[model samples]
Target: MNKIERIGVYTSGGDAPGMNAAIRAVVRTALYNGIKVTGIYRGYEGMIEGDFKEMVSRSVSSILQKGGTILKSARCAEFRTPEGRQKAYDQVKAAGIDALVAIGGDGTFTGAELFSKEFDIPVMCIPGTIDNDLYGSDYTLGFDTANNTVIDAIDKIKDTAASHNRLFFVEVMGRDSGCIALNAGVAGGAEALMLPEKDTAIEELIDSLEEARERNKTSMIVIVAEGDKNGGAYNVAKRVKEKFDFYDTKVSILGHLQRGGSPSSFDRVLATRMGYFAVNELIRGNRSATVGIRGSQIVSTSLEEALRGKELKLDEELLKIAQVMNI
Candidate 1:
């Protein structure tokens, strides 16, 4: 680990817009230090099948603005098996890999930790999920871009809501976390925000819509996370309509739309910073740790600390702002 000779990089889970930016940073920085880089295609599945290619400085050139992982990504539950993990380790040894860089979220980081522990090799993780659910880092690599995407869609939906004087329910991607929904709700000036962390006050929500009506408000927008306990948006909308006797409610599930598009200026910068710092950490002999941006500093803790399933807490200040703006 003194001098990185060859490093392998892989991405797992859903593809994020800023993934290529992270891969580019890792390759460019590693090559700058005279290290060989190998791209693991389709995640660890590619590792077992030997579906990898040598990555050069030119391989990732001009990919900073790209929207997907250059190495691609996947879920290889097979890799969890001892035989499968052994195959991956054997492949790495055969390919002369000195270190590994894994760009992904909680599940992916846990797998990287397991691989590193078994092989006793350095593994660095760059958080790349749009969910922004990963703990430790204030922001994941693709979050800014996804937030921008979510708010952009919300803005467009606003025009239609105002045109028809209707209530619009906009559901965003947040499997078990609501950082995306909560942040976008505040930014988009949504009336009520629903997240997995808290229960939605349907009675209060109905009263708010009634109040908006009494005040001659033309439109109301509710931002609900996909993981919200109330169920999918359509079911919630139906319940709202039935209980409140309100019709003409529009449902707009942002779905994977928020995960597409080019990496924004903020996401690109964050990814590059994380990627370069991760390589440096491995050079310093760090293993079983996930490099994360903690309070504007690149500090990392044990992957064990990361796997505790801690979720990002909502910023109450932003919630306050959202409430004040709605008033």
Candidate 2:
């Protein structure tokens, strides 16, 4: 519709594992279509600073197996201001970038959505947070890799836990979402999981652990999401140790570790498909939307719908499985 010639791409917000794969797909897909591509460094901050580089297919080569974004990412509080957006818009026009492919989580989409409306340019987003908290996409880019990374740590911790007959309180990143805590808890075979979505009181936790002790369980592992109301794993462990002293308790905060890893086959393929879909949508004149995979199909959702803070329902089935598995 805009007779597009050149496109720009950038990653913002927290970096994720499969972001490199998505970047690769975007660059190669646009190049294959005979369109020029520009890589914007450090997201909106880079855009405002005019930090850009022309990207060729080779620029993204051999990066599919890497973690994090090649374009890099940063928070740009300045970009939230009208003046900042104006400066970014001017830079985009001067760089001859008619449309854009943005890869990041909600903050990235909010920026792209606002910038596109202000300047009337096309922008498509790929959800790229390890948290997988985005609404439009069922699975965000690095979620699988992050989940795998967490499970790996948990498995190792489990070995030591069994040997020492210890109780481990493992904290994982999710911020306000519990997706990671729930999925990783199930996969890691955690004894209990505390999520932000539900109120998991210390009393209930102590009761569960007591039950486990009664069953002659010598070791325990509890997975806590960062947003849990009972504070983090440290606080939870401290409180539990005060009441239930059945096993020696230890705390492990798997902070940024989950955000780094060679993405699994699932994440790599998902990123590639999302990136390809985003470019194709932009070519077809679609804009101000995000590309997502819902039930094995690639689909697009408007940024308005995506940014409404619509929470994905907690996995009830998984919760049931987690409960049953513990017994």
Candidate 3:
């Protein structure tokens, strides 16, 4: 049980909405507990470069509603090497940073787990990805906000598709998980969904479209996860057009738009809770764990346990509901 004094926090990997909110919560919570906080910019890159700023309660003011992270995020290929990690540790020791709080997805947790073990530093993680792919947490920090963004775009596309009598293929993020696609599909009433978790063939998609056509669906939208086997929205739309093109076909790649926006009521509150929980965990001598929400309760899991085999979050019941709703 290391007596953690000064703790450093950073956001890593891809940027997501509600990240700023998490940052705010972390900074304020640490300050409230009479702990010193340092903001690590650009993730591991910043740690290695010694790019740090002392953070206080006012440092995070008016940032709760902002999109993206104030600390920012970036991939650090250098951090993958022993030499780079050694340099980061040197910086941490020099700066008097005794512990760490990382906010990101799987890659972020993997790095934290390794760093904590090697340096024997107390660390905690906040699941701050829009993908919601992590297992321990019921919902990641930015997932709800990203879902809202996707449904907003889908609703607008639905209006245009209805007016033009078109079949729209909308692609959402999630290269490894389908949490965004599945939730957004059910919410948007998509005609079909192609997820990375499930192999959805073009022929099967055509058949589903054919059924929709028979049911006289004037305007149809199909949600495709970015990692779908048949490429992305454009390639899927092309394949579907070659086989069955009942209505004019179009493709819309939502791209990073789903990664931005003011987080919803759910995400802001969730981020705040997770951030506060993470700081407390570190102060209690807990190390190398991630803060997660089970049902209504906030919980902590060792990073080693949290980073176990990839979590398949696609809900079977949700898929059935999506199918029934489409019909």
Candidate 4:
């Protein structure tokens, strides 16, 4: 492989907490290795439009605690086309970027994988989604911070639920994964959880609520993932109300609030590690991969494997624990 002279870094897809930390690591690590870094604004759209900026160590300074990304992010329909990709390649060559470090989730990786194969430019990915649904990484960036945000809301909501003896169906931002809902639900001591991985029936949910009432529980909470088959928290709460009116029902959709917050220590460290490794891996000539952590160790998986491999499943043990503890 030719010697890498310049690397381009960008964040794409939905914004996640700790992305700036990852960007900081990528810029500083590349500079430390004597390679120039270009910040690609607005992801693929910027790549095609030549919205590039020279990145220095000072450019990323003091952004570690920041939420969202310094590079910004966007979904580019234009990037999915051959013509658009060709334009992006021209811009990348014009900017003299020899390699790339992409930050985001599956859509980001898919684009990176295609862009690398088409243009033969080395690319590495960092898992920066809060969903934690990506296959390669055990934990994605912002997952911890999102969970913390949800738990904080749950704690505060619980206060009102207790005061009114209400049943709160709190929805979190896991559209396809239950990592956020399950983890936060358990941590917040919710009475039940409706996850995407599990097709929880309305009858079963009512049973849980009825059981809670029988146990003389003053207030109950049912955490729901956004992708729950029963529709969102509002729909589930509506169905539950039709049958069981034991307590006043309410719905709290966390919405985009989960996507914004100063990253937790774990996420900051994880993003930094992933970002540092992504640059080093590209320098080492191991291209087209995603950086991830498995049990405290940072590892790289090929893009093909990371994108095509079986998705990480919800832990059955954790599911059982959530159920047992809810009692």
Report the C-alpha lDDT of model 1 over 1-327, residue by residue, as the tens digit: 366699999999888888898898889888888888999899989888878899988998899998988788889989989999999888888999879999998889988888888888888888889987777788888899999999999999999988987889999999798889889998898988888888876777787778767877778899989988989688778878987655479899888878889999988988888889888777778876776787778778778888785656888888778777876
The candidate scoring highest on lDDT is 4
Per-residue CA lDDT of candidate 3, range 1-327, in tens?
A: 756678899999998888888888888888888889999999999999999999988899999999999998999999999999999999999999999999998899999999999999989999989999897889998899999999999999999999999999999998988889999999988999999989987988888889888988898999999999899999999988997867999999999988888889999999999999999988887878999999999999888888895655577888889889989
- Evaluated against the true structure, the overall lDDT of model 4 is 0.94
lDDT of the structure predicted as candidate 2: 0.93
From the highest lDDT down, the ranking of the candidates is: 4, 2, 3, 1
C-alpha TM-scores of all predictions? 0.96, 0.99, 0.98, 0.99
A best-first ranking of the candidates according to their TM-score comes to 4, 2, 3, 1
Query: What lDDT score is found at residue 184 in candidate 4?
Result: 96
- Which residue segments of model 1 deviate by more than 4 Å? 1-3, 309-311
Better of 1 and 2 by lDDT: 2
Query: Which residue pairs does candidate 3 place in steric collision?
Result: none
| TM-score of candidate 4 versus the correct structure, residues matched by position | 0.99
RMSD of 4: 0.7
* Clash count per candidate: 0, 0, 0, 0
**Candidate 4: where is the Cα deviation over 4 Å?**
none
Error of 3 at 314 (Å): 1.3
